[model samples]
Target: MTTICVDVMGADKEPAVLLEGVAQALAADTDLEVLVAGAAEFVEPFAASHDRARALVTTEVITMSEHPAQAVRAKKDASIVRAAAAVRAGEADGLFSAGSTGAVLTAATFGVGRLKGIKRPALSLPFPGISGRPTVFLDMGANADVRPDVIVQFAQMGRAYARAVLGVAEPRVGLLCNGSEETKGSEMALAYHEALAAADCGFAGNAEGTDILAGTFDVIVADGFTGNVALKSIEGTGKFVLKRLKAAMGASLKNKIGMALLAGSLKSLAGELSGDEYGGAVLLGLRAPVLKGHGATSARAVCQGTLAAVRVVRAGLTEKIADACELSA
Candidate 1:
């Protein structure tokens, strides 16, 4: 059975949302189980109600503003720390949290420990793609400053993710750049291309930002700064388009009738673009699977994120990444 430890506190929504997520997860997968870390009184009742969920009972909660490293060490019983510890101690197969991203990253790296040959672990997000699967985009907001070697690492991990989650046997890896030309990006891009081309994975050469959602490649690699900006832009644009569509559909009775005629298709398209459907990003290259849920996590989003983590754990991503990292190194 695959067990995932989830931090049930410090999300944009209440801890109760995580419980809703747990109930959804139990209903979705028959072979999955969850361990929740948070205040016992508040969380235990929910755990008792669910056959697959168990509460760890933690008192300390780490807020976004707290120092990640210090809070981790000082508050041994903090939800995030204890969640990571569960993975480290073999009590769970993975960890999930919608808490402070920095603290979660710190806990996964320091508490659970980095996999062998991993210099820096990356936050890999699945961006909506035209081909009905999300393109694995790495360094979503982890490590603003990166090296060529780091890009190489991202490429390997991203390919593994696409293969595992998306059922792509051999994913095409692209280095995100300003233009499609090999010489278009900065020195880092040039260096990355050179290194990635020789690596074991399928290197698709330079890809422009436009190619991200166009299904040009299954895996897209970028520096954290660039990747984060692109991710936010994609998210904002998706929201903007959805809002405009809603307004246009409700503009008049005639338009509303037309929308009603195409409502099924529109709903499908909306689901394709919804971030909640995709759940959240995975922090790659760690010793165990770690999923970072959206801060404004809904019940559906939590369910999606937990399921994604289960996919990663069943994929044996941690062991596969360790083997691939050594080869790339």
Candidate 2:
């Protein structure tokens, strides 16, 4: 059985909505055990309503609205910290949280630590590109700035993520830059581009923001600042398109017919492309896989994120990342 710890105190909706996800997951997978970290009394009612939720949940609720670090340090009972402890104690295979991004990151970093030789871990996001090919972008928001050597490590880790998660044979890596020209943008990007090329990597040269949407490379490497911008842009675009499509469908009789005929396909396609649907962004270059879901996640999103965590661990992503980094104890 796969065990997962969920931060119930995290997210905008609190434990109620989160319990829905836990219930849904438990009902779907008998082999899944959920460790809920929140107020146990609040969760008991929800658990009682569902048979599987009652049977599968191992109640362990942490308090709400406390500073994550201090709470983790002082309370030792905060939901996010307890979840991390669950992972550290080998009681849970992975931890999922939609809580304070800072708190979750801090607690996990302190509890799990980074893989050896990794300066700091990065968050890697995989976007479905043109032709359904997935491209990975790294350092989404872990560290705002990075050194040239760290950028190289990001590239290697991003490539490994693509290979394991996306099943690419030899993922092509590209440095995200302002322009494809060699002498474009800041000294940081140009210097890092040169470093990536020099390293023993399948560097595909430089790629611009435009190329990312056009599916230019298998992996996109950038510092957290630029990478976060690119990730938000893609997410914003998806939302805009979906909204416009819905409005168009409601405007006319012909459009209604078109929607009726294509609704199933559209739903499936949307499910495949959504960030929430794809589960969560992973904090890569760590000893264990850590998935960070949206703060406003739904039960479906949580379930998906848990499934993604299971797949990442089962695929041996951590070992592959350590091998790619060539770290020595």
lDDT of each: 0.84, 0.76
- Clash statistics: count for each candidate: 0, 2
Model 2, residue 40: what's the lDDT? 67
For 1-329, candidate 2 gives per-residue lDDT tens digits of 77777776658776778777877777777777766667766556765675534322334433336565675677556667767777888877777787777777877887766888888799877766776677787878888899888999998888889888889989999889988987886989988988888997678888888767566799888999998888778768767887888899989999889888988977766655556656778888766778888877788888788777777877788888888888862
TM-score of each: 0.91, 0.85
Q: Which regions in candidate 2 have their CA more than 4 angstroms from the true location?
A: 27-30, 42-75, 244-274
Output the lDDT of residue 228, model 2: 85
By lDDT, the best candidate is 1
lDDT of 1: 0.84
Cα misplacement distance, residue 50 of candidate 1 (Å): 2.3
Cα lDDT for residue 104, model 2? 78
Question: In model 2, which residue pairs have backbone atoms overlapping below 3 Å?
Answer: 38-61, 38-62
Q: By TM-score, who's the top model here?
A: 1
